[model samples]
Target: MIERWSRDQVLALAPDAASQKAAAGVSAPAKWLVTGVTGAVVWGECKGSGAKPYRACVDLSEPAYKCSCPSRKFPCKHALGLLLLWSADGAPPVEEPVDWVGEWLDQRRERAARQEAREKAKAEAEPTEKAEKVTDERRARQRAERVEAGLADLERWLRDQIAHGIADARRTGLRDWDELAKRLIDAQAPGVSSAVAGLSRVLRHEDWPARLLAEYGLIHLLAVGYRRSAELPADLAETIRSRVGFSTPKEAVLARPPVRDHWQVVATRDEERDRLVSRRVWLHGRATGRPALVLSFAPVGQVLDASLVLGTTLDADLAFYPGAAPLRALVAERHAPATPIQAPPHGIRVAEVPGLIADVLARDPWTESWPLILTDVVPARSGDAWHLTDHHPKEENAVPLLPSAAPPWNLAAVSGGHPVTVAAEWTPDGLRLLTTWDEYGRVVTL
Candidate 1:
C-alpha cells in the first residue's frame, strides 16, 4: 500500500521521512512483540545499507522516526526501504549485512519481557500485603503522630493564606501551593496537598469566590475524613488514608481487577505552567463504557506519551497509577488501527454566537474562550462590537479557549478562505485551535 502511494503524498502525511522509515522498519519483521497499549508495536527488519549497518524504529502512534544512520528524513532511507519491503506481496529479502537489526529487536523483547515480569510479580504480591495487618501498636502510633504534624502544618498554611487575603494569596500562586504541598508531603499529609493544589487552579480563574468556597469545603471534607478514618468503612477509610499521604505499593493497584475495554480517546489537553507540563488524557470506555480521565505530568520539555489521539479508539488494558487519586493510566494495547478523528457532533453557527458560547460552556463551563472556524468570514457589527461571522454555519464547532488578560478575541484565515476564531487571551503564543481539517491552527499573531 505504501509503495503504491506517491512518495510526496506519504512524506506529506508524515513529515518525518526518517521517522516513517524507522517505523516501517519496525513493521518489516514478522516477529510481533506486544508492547504496552499506548499504541506500542515492535518488530524486526533487515535492510541493505551497502557499507554500514541499519536499524530503526517507526512508532505509528507518534509517527516518530529514529535511525542509527544520519539521514535527516526522520526515519531515513533504511526505514522507508524496510517499510516498502513489508507492504509488498512477496518482498525480496536483502542480504543480511550485520546484527544491528537483530540486536535492536532483542533489546525490545528483553525490555518487554522485564516489564511483563514486573507486572506479574506486582499482581502476585498485592493480596499478600493487604492480608497482613499492622500488628505493631507502636508503628500505628508513629504513623498517627506523623499525620497529626502534617495536618497542623496544613492548618497553619490555611490561616496564613486567610491572613494575607485573597489578593495576596493570588500573588503567592502555585509556588505557594507547591511549597505547602511539599510541607504536607514531609508531614505525611499528601491528601491535603492534593486538595490545596486543586484549589490553586481555582485561584487563577476569574471567579475566585465560588472556587474558594468549594476548595474550603474540600478541605473540611479532608479534615473530617482523616479524623474519622478509624470508624469509617474499610474502602472509605482507605481512600481517606491514601489521600492523606499514606503510601500504597504499586502492586496493590495492579492487584485490583483491571478496567479492560476499547477506550476512545475523547480529548487530549496539556498545560505547562511553572516548570510542570501536565497532560490530561480522557478516555471513554467502550465496554463498561465509563469516562475515565488520566493525568501525566513531566518537567519542562519532557514528553509524556503522545500515541493517544482524540476521537481514536483503542482496545487497551489500562493500569492506573498508584496514589491517593490514581487518575494516570498506562496503555496496554492498540486494539484497532487508528483512523481519522470524527468531527464534534454539536455544530457552531456563525450567526448564533451566543448559542455557540452556551454549547461550549455546557461542555466546558470553566472555559474562558470558545474556538470557531468560519468557512466564509464577513465582518458583522453587534451594537458597537465587531465580530467575524462564519458563512457555512454547520461546518464548524466551538472549542474551549483559556482566559487571558487582554482582548480575549482572535481570528485567522485557513486555506479555503475560512477564518478561525481563537480566544485572543490564551497566551500571546496564539490560539490552540482543535481542527481535524488542519494540522496547524490559523494563527493570528498580534
Candidate 2:
C-alpha cells in the first residue's frame, strides 16, 4: 500500500500561499468529477468553468505533478487539490489506472528506460583515449583562434570608441553595446560578451566616465592577457582563459584531487535574468578556513539543485577549478548528509576584509566580489544610510552596507540593537548582507 500524506504535508508542497488557498477551494468532492488512486499514482478530473473537466495526476513515488490546466506554475491548483483530496481520503482506491493516467505512466517509464540504457551504453563503451585527446586538442585550438580574432576586433573597436570621444559613446543607448555583445558571443567569447553587456550599467552611474574608463582598461587588459597567455604563469594563464570564456568539463574537474573538509554552507542567493535563474551558494571549510562558491542554474519555473541548505555543514570533498585564486568548486563527493549549524564555521573581523579583497584581486583582478563572514557587528542607521558598526564598545570602526541592499530591517530586528554575525558579499560598492546569526546563535536569512 502507498503510504498516505497528511493534509499539512500536501499543502506544504504549494509554490505559494495563493496556490495553497486555491487548492483548498478546489479540494471539495463537489469540485472533482472523479478521483481515484492506484498503486503509486493518483488521478482526478476537476470541474472547471469550461465545458470539459481538467485532468490532473500525481506520481506519488516522485511526488511529480501533471495537470491539463492553463497554468505555468508547477503543481498547478488542480494537481495540488487532487493531492489534498487524497490526503483527506477523498480519492478511493481503484484496481486499475484510468486510460489517460496509464498512458502518462507508460510514457514516463519509457523515457526512464531509454535514459538508463543510454547511460549504461556510454559507461560500457570502449575507450579511444588517444583519438579523443587529438579531437579535443583540435577543437581547443580552433576555439582559441576564434577568440583571438574576436579580441583583436574588440581592441580595435575600443580604440575607435576613445578616438571618437567617450561622451559620444555615452550618448548611445544600451542596445548599441548589446549588438557588439552579440558579435562577441557569436565569436565564442561569451565571457567577454557579458563584460561588454555590463558597460550599460556603468553608463547609468553619476561618475560614468571614470567607471567606464576603468572598465575599458580592464577589458583591454583581458584582451592582452589572452594574447600573451603563453608568457604568463600556468595558473594565471588558466585564469585569463577562463575569464575569456573557456570552460573545464565536469568530468575533468571531478577527476582532480579533492579537498576534504567540513564545509559549512553559509548562505545562498538567487538571481533571475532573461528567464534564467542562477543560484550562488557560499561555503567555508571549518578546518582549512578556505571559502568556496558553488553555482547552480535552471530555467525560470524549473527547480534548481537544493541539496546545499543554508546554515548546514557537510563532510564533503570539493574539487576546485584551476585559477590563481581558486574559490569556485564542485562538491565532488559527500561523506554524509548535511547537518544543521547555528553559525558560520569561521568569521573574520570587519577590518580584515580590505586585505583579503586586495589579496584576491591581486591574483584574479576580474573577480566581482568575495564572500565574508563578519563577527560582532550590529546594523546601524545613519540618517538615510546603513552600516555595520563594531559591537565592541572600544572599537569605533564600521563598514558601510551596499546602497542597493533592501533596508536591513530584518537584520536590525534579529539583532535587537545588539551584536550579530553577518555573512555578506564584499564588492567595491559595499557589503551586501546575505545571512546573519542572531544573539541566540540562530541563523537568519537577510
Candidate 3:
C-alpha cells in the first residue's frame, strides 16, 4: 500500500519555489486523467504542449518520482503536481495502477539492479584503481592546498569580526554572510560554505549576539583543527579535514575493517541537496551499547537504502569513518535481515549525558549533535519552555528541550505525568527528541 504523503512533505521535495509554484497550478483533479495509486506507486496523465499527454508517476515506497516529460528538472512540475494531488485530503482513493504504471515500475527495478551491480564491481576494483592514480593524488593535494589557503582567509576575516565585536558584525547586514559563503564555495570549501549559510538561522534568534559568538567560536575551532590536523590521530584528522569540506572517497572508507554488531536503527534525519538526498541514520549496538551513524545519499528520484528502519535490529558490519569520536559509519556487510524490536535498548541516565558530551567534544570540538538515550525522564512544561526532568528523585536534573520538539502535547500525554525513555540528539543547541518509549517498552518515533 502507498503511504500517504503530507502536503508539507511534498513541498519539501521541491527544489525551488518555481517548481513548487508550477506544481500548485496543476494540483486539481481537472488537470489530470487516469490518476490513481496502486501498490507503492501513484500515477496520472496531464495535458502537455506535446501531442501526447505527459505521464507522471511516483513510487511512494521509495518515494521517488518519474515523469514522462522532457524537463531536465529531476521531478519536474508534473510529478510534483501529481504528488500534491495524491497528498491532498480530498484525493480520490486509488487502487490497481494502469498497465503502463506496472511496466514503468519493472523497468525502474531493473535499472536499479544494474546500477547496484556496477557500483559493487567498481568497489572491488578501487584498490588497484587508487594505486594507479598519481595524477589524481597530485590534483587532490592541490585542492587541499587551495582549501588550506581559503581557511587562512576565513580565519583572518573571522578575527576581524571578533575585533570589531559581534554587534557590529550583525549590524553589517546579511550581505557579509552571503559574500563569505560564496567565497568558501569559490575556494572549493563547499562544506564550510553550507555551514556559513546555516549561520543565518542562528542570527535570527532573539539572543543573536550569543549565538553569533558561539558560531564564531565554532568557525575558529574548525580553522585551528584543520591547521593542526596532522598532529591529531588518523581518524580525528580525517574528521577535521572532512568537516573542512575535504572529500574522502567513499570506496576507500568502505574498504576499511568493519565493526560487527547486531545494529539497532535508532532514528534518522533527512535533508535534501541538489544532487543527493542526504540521510543520517543513527545505530546502537544491541550487546555492545556503542553508537555509530550511517550517512546515505539518495540520488534525485531514487530510494534511500531500505536496509535500516527505526526500531529494528540487524546483524551487520559497519565501517566507521576515521574520527576521534567515530559516529558516521557505512554498512559494509549485512549478515541477517532486520527484525522489528519490541523495546528500545537500555539507556544511560540523564546525569551521564554531560560527561558524554564533554568526551565527544574533547575529540571533535565542532561536533554538532550526539546520540543519547534516557531511560526515565518526564516532559515538564515551565511557562513557555519544555524540559526533560529526571523522574528518579535521587538522580534528578532538568535539561532544557529544544523549542522545535514535535508538538509537545502528545509527548506530554504519553508521559501521563510520569517517566518514559527517549532517544534524542544531544547538542549545544539543546535536546531534540527523536523517539520515545512508554513504560510498557513500546517505542515511538517522534
Candidate 4:
C-alpha cells in the first residue's frame, strides 16, 4: 500500500519541546503528547541513545501520534514514522490522552485567557491618564537643548564640507554619509542625521539642484525649529526639537510594561544612508496573532542586537516608543526564547491565477522574493481561463500575494493542484519568500 504521508512532513508539523527536558541520560522513556485538529490526542514515549525506541498512543478521532525523544528537532523521526504507519493502516489507535497532557492543554487555555484580559485592560486605560504635563515640559527642554547643539555641529560640518569642496565629499563615497550620520547620532540629533543622509541620496540622483535645495531647506528648518522652540505649540515644538537632535534613554522608554506576547520574528531588513544605519525587525504575535514592527538604530560601525533571528519565537514583553504612533516592543524577560515558528501558508483559488496573470500580463508577478508554499493545487480550465489552485492553511494565516509587472523568480508546479513560486535565492535554513499580493487581488510579497 502507498504511504499516506512522508515521515519528514509529519515531523515538520510537531511543536518544539526542547525546553522541557532534563540534562543527562533519560532514566525512563521521554514522552510527548500532541493534539490534532479533530480533538484527538496522541501520547508516546521514546527510549535508547544511538538507536531510539518510540512508543505512541494513537487517536482515531483525529490522526495524532506522540513520541518520546530528546532531539530539539521537534517530533524527530520516530513520531513521523509512527504517523506514517498509522496513516497507511487507515485505523487510529483507541487511547485517551494522559493526565499530564490534559493538564498542559488546560494551562495553555488559561494563560491565553489571562493575556487577553490584560490586553483589554491596557487598551481601556491608555487614553484616560492626564497629559503628564511636567514630564512633557522636562522632555521638551532637554530636546530643545540637544537640537541646538546638533544644529551647531551640523552647520560647522556643512561649512567644512563646502570649504573642502563638494567634489571632496563626492570622492569620499558612501562612507561620508556614515561618518556624518554617526556624528549626528553622537551629538544627540538623529533627526538631523536623517536629514543629512537624505542629502547623500540626492547627491547620487540626477537633477541635483532641487534635491540640494530640499536638503538645505531641511537643515534650515532644523536650525529654525531649535531657535523657535519656545514660541511653538507644545506638541509641535517637542516633535521639531526632538527630530533635530534629542534622544531619550532606552531605559526611560522601556520603563512602562510593554505589550507581552509570543512573538514570531518574521523578517529582518537593514539599510544605511549616509552615516546612519537602521535595522527593521518584524514580529507576529502568536497569542494575539497580530503583527508588530520594531526598529533598532546604530551609528557607523556600531553593531545592533543579534538576538532576533528569522523564524524563531520569543515570548517578549515590549514597550512602545513614546510618540503619536509608537511601535510595540520587548521590555523585560527578553531571554525567554521560544521555538522557531513556520511561516503561514498562502494559497490561491483554482481560478484566480490565470485571470490575474493575463490581466497583469507579467512573466513574473511576485515583487519581493517570498517563498510561496501551495498545499492545495487543483487544475482548472474555463471557457477562456486556465489557472492553478493553491491554499495556505496554517494557524497564523497565509501572507497575501501581490500582483507585479514582473517577478524575479519562476513558479514551480507541486503535486497537489497548486503551483509554488519561490524567490530565486535559497538559504541554508530554507526558502525565504516575500509575502505580498498582486493587482489581480492576490498577496504576492511585502
Question: Judged by lDDT against the true structure, how good is candidate 3?
Answer: 0.83
lDDT of 4 by residue, 320-369 (tens): 65432234354456757567555442333433433533433232111112
What is the per-residue lDDT of model 2 for residues 38-86, given as tens digits with 9 covering 90 to 100? 9999999999989999999999998888899999988899999999999
What's each prediction's TM-score?
0.42, 0.69, 0.67, 0.37
Q: How good is model 4 by TM-score?
A: 0.37
TM-score of 3: 0.67
Best by lDDT: 2
Cα lDDT for residue 373, model 3?
77
**Candidate 1 positional error at 70, Å:** 56
Q: State the C-alpha lDDT per candidate.
A: 0.53, 0.90, 0.83, 0.51
Q: List ranges where model 3 is wrong by over 4 Å.
A: 1-132, 273-276, 299-301
Error of 4 at 308 (Å): 2.5
By lDDT, the candidates rank as: 2, 3, 1, 4
Please give, for residues 307-385, the per-residue lDDT of candidate 3 as tens digits. Answer: 6888888999988777778888888889988888768677887788888789889888878899987877888878888
Pairs with backbone N, CA or C atoms under 3 Å apart (clashes), candidate 3 = 235-322, 235-323
**Of 3 and 4, which scores higher on TM-score?**
3
